[model samples]
Target: MPKGYEMLPNGIIRIKSDNSMYDPWEIKKSQLDGEELTLIGRVVWAEQKM
Candidate 1:
């Protein structure tokens, strides 16, 4: 885990390209095209915690 990233719970990731869905190929914290997506099931972080 990074300094500002946490694990996701029951989350689903989706890969996108040009603002479009890539396909059924989703993933976890990773880097694509030299970019660190830092995704946990497509979730960067918990935007809202209620």
Candidate 2:
């Protein structure tokens, strides 16, 4: 699950951690602009690769 993903009215996804939106876009719960996006089974790292 995304760190700051929240379900808004009418089913939109809002990523609070994304300080680039500047305005509220298609922020919904469990949905990414009516599309289901996931990072499951994906490898992640806290530090950048050097």
Among the numbered candidates, top TM-score falls to 2
- Give lDDT tens digits, candidate 2, residues 1-50: 12355666775665543335345345345533456665333235455779
Candidate 2's TM-score:
0.33
Candidate whose lDDT is highest? 2
Clashing pairs in 1: 13-41
The lDDT of model 1 is: 0.42
Estimated TM-score for each candidate: 0.22, 0.33
Report lDDT per candidate.
Answer: 0.42, 0.49
lDDT of 1 by residue, 1-50 (tens): 22223345544345444323343355454434445554344435555678
Residue 18, model 1: Cα distance from true site in angstroms: 0.7
Instruction: Give the distance in Å from residue 22's predicted Cα in candidate 1 to where it truly belongs.
Output: 5.3
RMSD of each: 11.7, 6.6
Name the runs in model 1 displaced over 4 angstroms.
1-9, 19-24, 28-50
